[model samples]
Target: MRFVPLSSRLLPGYGTLVLAITLVGIGVSITRPYLSLFGTDVVHMSAAELGLFMCVNGIGGILASTWLGRLSDLRVAKKYIMLVAAACSALGYGSFLVIHSYLPLLIVSTVLLGLGASAFPQLFAYARETASRVPDVDATFATSSLRSFFSLAWVIGPLLGSYLLQAYHFSGLFAATAFLFVAVLAIVFWRIERRPPAGILGSQPVKSFAVLQNRHVVTACVSYVAVYTASSMNGLYMPLFVTKALHGSDRMVGSVVALSAGLEIPIILGLGALSARLGKRPLLLFGSLCGALYYVGAWFAQRPWEMLALQLFCATFIAISVSIGMSYMQDFLPDAPGSATALYSNTNNLGQMLGSLLGGAIAQWAGYREVYLVCAVLAATSWLFLLRGKRFKAQEQKALRAALTSQDIETTQTRRAANGD
Candidate 1:
């Protein structure tokens, strides 16, 4: 058997995507460590208000992802859409300079930042779009590598965020985030603004709701909702849980996040490369199952170190669910890659929203430790959904092949008619 090397499959502009994703990851993380504190201290938001704030943020992200995701599928170039998203994000983060009170922060954070953050799906769309232009390059593998760059960013961002927050405070943090976005925007604009959009086959605007009718898309979206809900629970309350439940310090919280990302980075890259051979569905299912196990492990963790140790499992789960999951989603919608990516992102945002809203309410009544168990259940549910939908995969593939064959036949007939043959 002839062995195919991974590097041989890489498409053009892979390096550029790596840089862009890294910057985005860092920019987003620079503010993450201080976001809740900034809301509470700078704006004096109550707990309920803060939760509502997060929900609004998540909703804004979902709306942006949905609208812009569909927009990417239109005649417009994905890079330009990316530029607009970056500009909006810059504007959104820039609001921090003028924001002093609650209402203003709420408005800017939800509408502006939310819209700005929509660039994430656009970035994925752009990279995938670029790869699609080149023959023989596996777009999934290329995008997976790009996605791992995000994990790399998280590893660097949070630690840097912690230091900047302590030294220069909110001003430094916001300024850094703004700078990162501006830099990325400038790079993307310079590189792609004048370039023509990737000529994707059958690339046309798709009715957003039409995708939901497909069982594979619907089931995948629901599975992601559960997966992301579990993630949101970890993102929102794990730090509090560490402090209150495990008697760990704030620094420990940062370390916990770092450990997961550190472990996840290699896993994401490795699995992404292997995905070509291993296949997306198996990776997704295995990851979902591991995710459930990780949450269960987290629920049982008694010490901060135990939480750190549990991250090994968390990394495996993330490796599949994050980048690999999105790639798997694209397999079901080869003709509408942008819409497919948008659906994946929308599910993620929805998950974050539901997780934050419910995680808080649950924690108040059931205690923080119990929340992990709930997350474990959600993860398991996601796995079941994925497993049940496995049977439909073959059907979806057959339909896609038939559609492509019909298109090819029609094109050949047109050429023959033009030739008067």
Candidate 2:
């Protein structure tokens, strides 16, 4: 037998895949902080309108991800799909430079780049295919590690955006993000090698809406949505919580948010190893519980230092919960990893959109403190879903084993009967 080298045993185009995802992450992060700022300052849109824009964008992503994920599984050209997505994002974001009206920007933000955000689903599908081709690779871990790279981008993108906004205003940030997307498209086109079609990744054709029928998957998706919502709403309101409630400054909010991001690094690095040893369910449940506790603590925080400490605690739990949830989703839908991932991704986006809207509304009606309490309730409620998830997983494993055992017994009986025993 001819021996294959270790490098050859690795996934094809893995390097390019990582680079593409990292650039996408950076591109999004580069403009994230300025989205709200742009709506308020440049477009002169109200908070409700901004929230609706986010919701529509999220809904667009939800539609695109499921359809595109199915397309990728059907062996469509992944590089071409990525190129289209990146190109659309670039054009949409670039157009913002010339269009000053709220309606045009809203349409661009919600329909155009929002649809392009579907690229992540296809990107994940591509990663799954590449990882599947390689020997001795854990696709779950590879995917998790790929996602952690986004956090690294998160660390730098927002800080850069904030600085650029200080210097050149909202147009500068939008233009910069457009340039980043163009760079992403260029790098992916240059690096990825196209492959011939393999059969559809799944055993049968899957309808886009059919995925929602899986109860455990639905529970997991909803739990994830809740977790992400808490994170997004907190990010939006934390500045106010620190400044008005705790008597702090922009510098103080920056320090706390930075600390939160810093704390996630170690958690992300260690999560896979921990999951291997401790198993996915325990980690998921523990992380969810911890998230609930963190929000509860945040509600009680009275000083800037206390808020900072609470946020650090929250980041660790969020990292663990998200990593575990993602791994769990892949495990449950092993045959359709892309679709599973897309569902989780959509749930996360939906959560963030709803959280921002709801949190803003609560803050406006009652106060920041009430908003914190609501997030606490939401996080805690997520744990209930996890409890049911544990039972569902157990039943599934048992049924699978029982079916296998029955098949084995039937095969043995048939052999003996054929031998005239």
Clashing pairs in 2: none
| lDDT of candidate 1 over 47-99, digit per residue (tens) | 56666777888999988877777666755667887888788888788788788
Instruction: State the C-alpha lDDT per candidate.
Output: 0.78, 0.71
TM-score of 2: 0.84
> Positional deviation of 122 in candidate 2, in angstroms?
2.6
Q: In candidate 2, what are the lDDT values of residues 1-421, reduced to their tens digit?
A: 2443445434667777777877787778767645665666777766566666666677777777766666655566667777888988898888778887977777776667765786666677667767767777766566667667766677767777766777877778788889888988898788876654333433432333454566766777777888878877787777667777788875576566666666776787677667776777677778777787788888888888987777666777777766667767656545455666677777777887788788767766787778778888888777787778654455784554354445545766899999998
Q: After superposing candidate 1 on the true structure, give the runs of residues whose Cα lies further than 4 Å from its correct spot.
A: 193-205, 391-395, 398-421
Model 2: lDDT equals: 0.71
- TM-score for each candidate, following the candidate numbering: 0.89, 0.84
On lDDT, the candidate that comes out on top is 1
Error of 1 at 105 (Å): 1.3
Every model: Cα RMSD to truth? 5.0, 7.4
